[model samples]
Target: MRTILFAALSAAVSTSALAQAEDPNLWLEDIEGQRAIAQVKQWNAATEASLTTMPGFEERRARALKLLNDPNQIATPDEVMGDLVANHWVDADHKRGLWRVSPLSAYLAGKPVWRTLIDVDALGKAEGKSWVWHGANCLPPEYQRCLVSLSPGGSDADVVREFDLAAGKFVEGGFTVPESKNSVTWADRDTLLVAMAEGEGTVTRSGYARIVKEWKRGTPWSAATKVAEASESDIGISPFAVMDGDIRRVAISRNVGFYAARVSMRAPDGHWVELPIPETAIFDAVVSGQAIARLVESLGQLKPGSVVAFDIAQMLSGQKPEPALVMEPTKSQAIEEVAATDNVLWVKALDDVSGKLFALRRQPDGSWSSKAMPLLDHSTVHIAGTADKQDIAFAAVEGMLSPTTLMSVDSTGKAATIQALPAQFDASKFSVDQRFATSKDGTRVPYFLVRRKGDSRPTGALIHAYGGFRAAQTPTYLTAQPYRSGPLGLFWVEQGGAFVLANIRGGGEYGPAWHQAALREKRQNSFDDLEAVARDLIRTGVARKDGVAISGRSNGGVLVGAAMTQHPELYSAVIAGSPLLDMKRYSHLLAGASWVDEYGDPDKPGDWAFLSNYSPYQNVRPGVRYPPTFFYLSTKDDRVHPGHARKMAARLSADGNRIYFHEYMEGGHSVGADRSEDAMRAALLWAFLTKEIGSGAD
Candidate 1:
């Protein structure tokens, strides 16, 4: 009977071939799916109608995109490093910051070596020029050399110019190609393997989806020969080594689903052999000689969070393959980090409830060790590891306060502190605590509370969360300092205020199980979880409901919109940033199709039944007393369309609700006007929140 029910659901929700080919949400074919599409169309029409005549709206948006695409506006290597150091590591002892855009620089003998960079900022702002850095092979090397991709500033062309880092001069042996290229890895001193997107007309129908193209180290810039072409949905390179001579094996995914297959290259004619996995659904895979490790999901199980291992040599050599489930699917064992070394594959697994590191180890014969790393008592753990499998680092440990400590455990079992914040912000007076509350179904949810010590006043509190996409809302020192130093100090704590980080169910904080529990038809779980956090804060007397303001970006924006409609009396103000409010048309919208895995397909009937019930745009009825809200979006948001925000604001405004809409003409998906622009926006958000939530006046 259960099987029959699942089959019925699957059939009803399955997408059409044409839809699947054009839209990522092809799996959602039920009645709810149709409604979702209809709602999106309605929202788009409303948004276009409202903004068509707005003075400079179109121009501003175009200007923003141009700025983003302008090479001069891009951050230099030094600027990128400084930003990372400033925002990521706030500790007084360490000098390193969180590495963004560029992955961790490759290190040899305890020194920095090579690094890669993309021209896009963390907020998806275009840097204009893309580049990579290669350093001396010497011990404790000097990284004074760089190869920069330089095209005419605003032209959408691909050109690379090699620059001598020390002399600040461009070398004559530079190259240019027709297609933009990235993910360049040095095979030898003279050979490069890069990921390229070529022959682009419409990527969905284009023959070149994503391919690995090789380049000779000293060769002039010319058309690249495709090493491998990926299917439309499947993308990602296998974690393999180029160290042992040739490119031994490559991992490729044929479908958008989470499954990967290995293609190995052997000598004696150099033919590529493909080993297919019939039963496993893998998202990522890494190969280390004879051993292969992969992140696998159980068939038909929404929350099969596990990592499996196989003997690569045995599989490729046509021997009886010994497939072992390296990491078993645990409700609590959420895989946070995984990497491959010469002989060992390292895995970092976390337990959901305590935000604690459960285990870190190398696969096969390596020992599994467990330690409770001291995290900021209220911050979520965000872990990042090196590409070469030598170091493992984590940011935003609870209780540290001011800045995050970049602590790395080396291959020799030695833990060293690499980087931290400079001594600018004081960390002595703050305190954070974790609290839990019971949801509507009696499910216990957790949230983080942060405030200054020695304050007992009924301060204003800002409760924030992003309860979708299995994206965890972890604690970090970046945004907290602004609040802590300003309104947070003057209003929340000094003037008596508080800050809350809600760990709602839709987030991966609790693992894939936590996310699956809150998906599709059960989407209400996220709302309930968030409400539970709010109630817990109120019950604890941390802040009254009327003094609380809720803020979230992207999918979290959807949460804010839904909350305002469902329980308007809970929050005094709502700040929805780049939200997808018109859920009915989310799949049909930009980048909306990619999110069907998180949110059920709206075109399908069964999905529609559940989606329409809580879709914030659909739920907004006439004559309801809604809380004052702020809507912010970007005109160049190629990911989540700005229409979501525009339409929501129009409907609310027409209905006589107080809604402040600020559409950034540029800045891509982030809507950050610039560094200075972001500062002003932050100030506005604080001021608005303070005024609405009754924070201490300046």
Candidate 2:
């Protein structure tokens, strides 16, 4: 996952004013440095000692672990190939998880007779590598030969090895892509379109593949043929292929930056043809000679947020561009995801914050008509899987207080609940409310409040805001897995505390315009939105000003870091996890350079002028009375450099702030490498929250 890198300083200033000397803690950037590791150990010991001294720390850890390792946890539903249902699950029994499968019949019957395809735990022990299951891509039609990816620890970079599903084993001497930030796509059973690091000079400055190569079966890595290459200014080029029935199309997306790309398709003649699509539009699917896409900017008559298609045949013939709109979402709506199912175009969208599904089918006139797929109210509806060339799709629906229910929708828009999760906790006693907080700019930002029913003035509140990356924050049981967060927050919700999820700006709540509202220099608006939500909660008496705790991971961590510094009086505690706090130096760190589009290029003096205004690391002052903050990051987090948190915590400590730091050895950009690690982290979070806010269990 890409972490958002933006934080705030109170005054407007230039990067020239905040030089490297101001951040003397830069030495901590040496992730594995002996001195840095020693300080991390010292800080971890102090934090664990203090928080563990709080009431219910041990019990909380035990309960959190129990729920995390629950034997009856829902197996996340995934479609292996259309004919079979599969899931990658991790629990106490399978620490490293299992890539297991079941027949479609058995899966739809609710008792999937799961057969393990890959025992990750066993494989890791045998290989002596903490192999994290990255993902897999199987060949089309037959879908037997697979390219399985495994990451060491939990880094974004992974190793891909070809596996034979029918034989249930790794293909001996088969196709393999060694560990790197590589992408391997099946061009055919015997050939692969690979984008990987060739050597020290082959990777982009952003630490991704700079060249696209083709690797055929039985060919040595040194003998692979180069297909395409991108400039150092670009992140990289990735190979993409689509197999729509007998029709197959292969292409590469040259990602010039984080939000921009130029796509070129390999025509039947084997020549690359550039499509005249917008640089920021997302390529969805190709069907009936039409190139389908979702636009990021208005294209002629078609507006942004419109799912449209143009004649691929016309483009190839160099004819004047003519486009057809498939779907257009309203200002309050955003297309969350899109898929093509044989004869139907599946669109799962969000209205306000509730999920609504839609299907577009071709009309006799060659145009498309859309119909709503009736879904549950106040619930999140996401496409779980779509059948191949079949007008059938699986949708998962869940709410803040509801367990997920996997629903199947056929071509006729008929829906059926195939699997419904049993409630993980007793949510019967809790109530959920969708409220709006008017920001300083007078924009109404939506947020969900989950709290105990009746006479519940929350003793404490956990307010969360992920206000960047255009990622939508939705309603679901706070289960971080199963596509999400649950019983863990139930610990606080049941204790007369409220859990608040703020749908602030710079998110997909209101589509592209909402996200664009806080881009670059305007990022302070997102912080304003979050502060408004906290103030609203206190004004409504849902939580005390001093009893409200804020938590954000990644970009959300950036939010917390800014909030704690700018409005420390609003929150009593701040939890920054896998955060990007030092805005000025972010681009100089690992993979941080790629995110210059999201957070602005600090090296450029113009971008740095605004960046210096809110950089949390530079904003830390000795005189300020800040909240006790807990900072944590993964040493293996290559995507968002751990140095962001390390340097920030070190500087804050030097400035007389009550700060605690912990760096785990594994689990890249995530809370943990395994279940127990996740549970322990949760326990520690709750411990600190309780220590600051007095448990809130009136």
Candidate 3:
């Protein structure tokens, strides 16, 4: 049956003979199939044996472990629940994590008397499940009750259980959602707006909850009242509740596309009222009584990337509220995050790829006043958590050379450091420099370089980028992962190697225009931009011509995959992790349907025309001298199917190309579930890089 299905899928992939070629490794897509698991184990063993045998591999692994297990690292607040700040902490002792909380006042001081609410490792042992902490949605006001989400094996699908925060225990006979990619929001003390995987017709094609029900206390899930439903073709529906001072408003966001959603609020009469706004407009947060939304497309007189505030009272009254612009970024600016406190809206943005924060407040006469937040210069500021009842927020500020420092901020924009992480690496010995590379379209692509001070000679370097999904690659501490953050100083830079962060097109660094430049048929621009950065690194004496490597995961994985296939001569090594390689079959895979808005649908003729051109799997040639590539993927990665890495690796090896494949059994889309696993992967990556490019100083 599986074989017949596989053959049918192959035939339906494309009408063209090239794409109609039968896939020999289709069985690998079965995920949990015995054959697939055996093959993954064999590859894992081979890759581990080969990489771990390298000189200094154990030492590097130990160093990474020490850094990852550092107890002095700041426990950044994940959320503010009433007067307590909640943080999920993971260390050598608590590998899974400890969902703990501390008084905001005590946390603001240097010492925090943390009370562990959920010991994830202990819970996992008690339940005999490898549970990973998803997060907790605590009820506002007193915040005594919370819905705790726990994922088995680190997959996106998780089981939700209600917990009593005051008692630090799971509430008996309380609400519980079965394992699925579900969402549960507290509508009141005894009511919940939940989107769960009940049975057939409950989940969308993208494997998310398509129906949302209002579940009440002491009742079966089936007895819950249906409040909202989205079409199966839609991405999914998520119910969210916002607390506006003393009032609570419930809304359902029907995600029609990845970046598009239609939000409707439940009126007092129990009818859903759709908000009169563009589907592309992001409903950021509700501050006071105003709904804040960030425009992705031009709406009326407001331009794209404009943050606007709308009065909620007018919308609830069946009237279209005129949006007042809170702030509009310049051409060189990009809004990163929009967070709200009780009375203030904090906009974290980037100016020419440098971090800048602003505080906007709605004034009398329906006007808005904005003021730049007093933050450290040349550092990235991320809002850790924001208080709902108080005009207080916490942000973590860090840079390429600076360790992360947690700060508490007031409505007046005054920020005071709460805790600072000790330097994990010798940052004083390194310097960060921003450079520009002219791309094929005459566009200037900005990239950051982290290298030893006073070193100008060509050396081995790694160019990292994620040029999709409007995600901006920002500067972080050395202990940060390079896949998301810009660089890894301890593993690469501290080892006398230069690390390059390519802020190419398709990223939010420069705003929506920057990302749109690399969309659809223009996706090649991201590849061109990446290659230009690699060449620029060589031309500027930052990296040896034959020693540059490129690495990215997921979207960035597609970037490097295209880079190696399109411009193989520019890079010596390529590391693609959990990538989307077979564009022809991506949409048919799990959750791939939701991303068609980002990457064009391959089933469509015109879209496939462009996707096929740069698809690494389809573009592979018999005799081309491609760079040595390493492919790592998680078997539990239900998001970006592991088949992408499997088939790509299989195809490359079949073509007699040098390739290494490692498929981890756990850690759905991420490197691992714990810090130790993350450290091991980092060490393995460094081993491969060093082996390919020769230890830094040439």
Per-residue accuracy of model 2 over 1-698 as CA lDDT, tens digit each: 00112111111112343554665676677777788788888988998998777778788778877877877666656554757777898888888799988887677667788889999989999999999998778776788999998989987778999999888899999998988877778888999999886656677777677788888888798888988998877887788887554677788888888888888888777878888877898888876677788888998888888899877767766564767888999888999788776677788899988999998876777689888887898798888887655567789998888888888787687987777877777878888999999999899999998888884455788887788888998877765421212244777777778888899998888888888988899899999999999999889989886788888888887788888888877888888889989888787777777788888999899999999888888787778878988887788887777878888887777768888777788888764788777777777777777777766644
Residue 546 in candidate 2, Cα distance off native in Å = 1.3
- TM-score (C-alpha, index-matched) for candidate 3: 0.96
Tell me the tens digit of each residue's lDDT in model 3 across 485-530: 2224457877788888889898899888888988888999999999
**Which wins on TM-score, candidate 1 or candidate 2?**
2
Estimate the overall C-alpha local distance difference test score of candidate 1.
0.51
lDDT per residue (tens digit) for residues 1-698 in model 1: 00000000001233567655643433322322455446445544543454434443344344333322332211112221211210121111211112223324422122333232322232122443321121111000133334454322111123444444445344466433333423343333445555544445212221223566667755654655666655554423321223211233433333342222444433334445555443344334343543433343553232356665555566566664645555654665566554443343455555543444333444456333334444434334444433233334333243325454455554445555544434323556667777788999998887767777865655567777888766666655533433211222222443347877787888777666677778777888888888887877778777765777787788887788888899988877888887888788776665565566677778898888888888998788899978888776655455576667766776787789877666554454655434333443444555556556765322
Query: lDDT of each model, Cα atoms only?
Result: 0.51, 0.79, 0.82
Counting clashing residue pairs in each candidate, in order, gives 42, 12, 0
Off by over 4 Å in 1: 1-202, 205-249, 258-296, 299-303, 318-320, 328-333, 353-382, 385-402, 422-425, 454-458, 478-494, 696-698
Off by over 4 Å in 3: 1-21, 484-489
Of the candidates shown, which would achieve the greatest TM-score relative to the real structure? 3
Better of 2 and 3 by lDDT: 3
